[model samples]
Target: MAALQKKQSINCKVLVLGKSGVGKSYILLQYTAPPQEIVQMPKLTTVGVDYKYGTEKIEDTEVKMSIWDTAGQEKYRPIIQTYFKNSKAAILVFDLTDKQSLQDVRYWLREVKLQCGKDVAKILVGNKCDLPHEQPDQALIQEYCEEFQMEYIESSALQKINIQEIFVKLAKKIYQQHKASIPQNQLKQNSLPANEAQNQNSTSSNKQISLKNSKPKQKKENDGCC
Candidate 1:
């Protein structure tokens, strides 16, 4: 048998949007951190634009996720549009305990529509769900999701609630959408990783050893896109 090579990686860029101090950075921190590691989310705020990278397994394919975290402050708004181009999805985050953050997300949603295609995936994330507070208006949440084809999720980065699930959900959705364009022959041939050459007789061609919790080493990036 010919030496098998790893499946080609698909690059998917995702944009994270929300008001300042809404735990946008924290969520990304937890998502990239090792699953078993107890992460300490810092009191950090994005300035211009930042990038976080992680890989996920989508069936036999390996997906490289580039999460673009943009500054929510008004001064950085002018530069945010540059990162919006060709985004696979827009994650609109808000502090669940803060009504104002929830309201601001509507504006964020509008911003996404103006910059991205209608077909672009949008996810409404209510962060800081670990805190106690009055819920945002149910009607508004329903209306927001209805306005655009999107999914709603409540998460708490501090508590590591639903951090992993959100990325997996986004990756799977994006992969499905992109799958139609791939060449069938290429997909079939690259089903196995190069390191698995010893297991050439394995019948499950699409089975991949998941390294989801182990992220590749990368330097922290700010005011940049990856």
Candidate 2:
């Protein structure tokens, strides 16, 4: 994920929903903030909800996402819960080194379901994967996502591992989820020359907009495709 570039028409609200100390702030900072401006938060705890606006160039598609970094502690839940209604997608992060964090996925998933739009794209993220410790079992991760109806990925914000992917992949999912809302003219093939449009029409057109359509696939086995 690149830093915020010139604004684009493709936009959506992405809520970074997770527990405290799950590296949500660092993840957002690394993905969105430019090097010179990076501010290290000592406490690493959000008071309520923080907002960041940035553009990501994903497989040629430029997406301007309004990232809402929410406070994960119990007391601040109400203050941050309001934004769930407008959130187009969610990145539910958990501390990978903390097994208890994995168990808390249910509360966050249910919270999104209760407050977000019915079709909101939800992904469960396991942060700090680079740490040397007993990692989450692959089977358990799969089983959990199936029960919650969301996707999951392990990342280390400090190491910059899978930081960009977390957003790029989820952005793609959100793009596809709200595709019907996009104007016909913005669809790649529509803006092409007649000859080009004719050629593109012969192939799977949406694959052009959603880069992943041409690729293998992603994490959440049961979260369904993007």
Candidate 3:
């Protein structure tokens, strides 16, 4: 079998938003991977916003992701919303074992749309999927995803289930969004060189005309000599 090759990466910003204790930071750490040692779970809650830099290879494109893990506590909600300013994609997580966490998904979804703008690509993540027997209806989650037009995935940051898949899929969405804009940008750039050349030529011609007009007329031999 041919070996899969990684592509050159481009920088992109992705935001992770959810209620506190939903393991949003863990999700980022799962991908970031701390030195292959036994790593203790972080007890500290995210303050305003936490950032981790990582890369994800989706097909031929490598996305150098600026993954922002935002504070999910209500007190920090306002502060967290500011991180949404530059986000191209978002992962809105909910704890699968906590019913209230599931409920809060709706509120978070609303905030993401309002603050990040309607065009931002989003995924609804049901985290802590390894927990046994959750009451939060899978059907309800599916329906919410369908209604919001967001991708839905179950992930366990602790067990590392579907962790990479979450980022890969979100990165794909971001990549597609960026890819869609390429043609218009290319069109603008392609048109620029010709337009610039035309302007330069016009300016040069105008300068020559102005010089000729400003010069004193040559004295004709048969006419009055200057």
lDDT of 2 by residue, 1-226 (tens): 2223333356788898777888899998888777666555345667888989877665445777899999889998888877787777788888878888777776887787788745777778888878876867678678767875667778888878998888878877766665666677676644465665665665666666577656665755776666
Write out the backbone clash pairs for model 3. none
Q: What are the per-residue Cα lDDT tens digits for candidate 1 across 1-226?
A: 6565546567988999998989999889898867666545567888999998988898877879899999988788889988888887878998877888888888778877888777676778889888997877888888988998777888999998999888887777777767766799655545545555446545344344334445698977888765
Candidate 1: residue 200 lDDT (0-100): 56
Winning model by TM-score: 1
**Which regions in candidate 2 have their CA more than 4 angstroms from the true location?**
1-8, 38-41, 58-61, 147-149, 180-226
Instruction: Judge candidate 2 against the unseen true structure and give its global Cα lDDT, from 0 to 1.
Output: 0.76
Ranking by lDDT: 1, 3, 2
Ten consecutive residues with minimal summed lDDT in candidate 2?
1-10
> What is the Å distance of residue 96 in model 1 from its true position?
0.9
Per candidate, the number of residue pairs that clash is 1, 0, 0
- Using TM-score as the measure, name the better of candidate 2 and candidate 3: 3
Q: Candidate 3: list runs displaced more than 4 Å.
A: 1-9, 184-226
**Each prediction's TM-score versus the true structure:** 0.74, 0.72, 0.73
Stretches > 4 Å off in candidate 1: 1-8, 35-39, 180-226
- What tens digits encode model 3's per-residue C-alpha lDDT throughout 1-226? 3223323456878888888999998888888876475377666578898888887777557888888988888999877777777777888899987788888888877877887777777888989888895567878788778877789888998888999899888888877776776798564543355556567668999999999889688966866555
Instruction: Give residue 16's error in model 2 in angstroms.
Output: 0.8
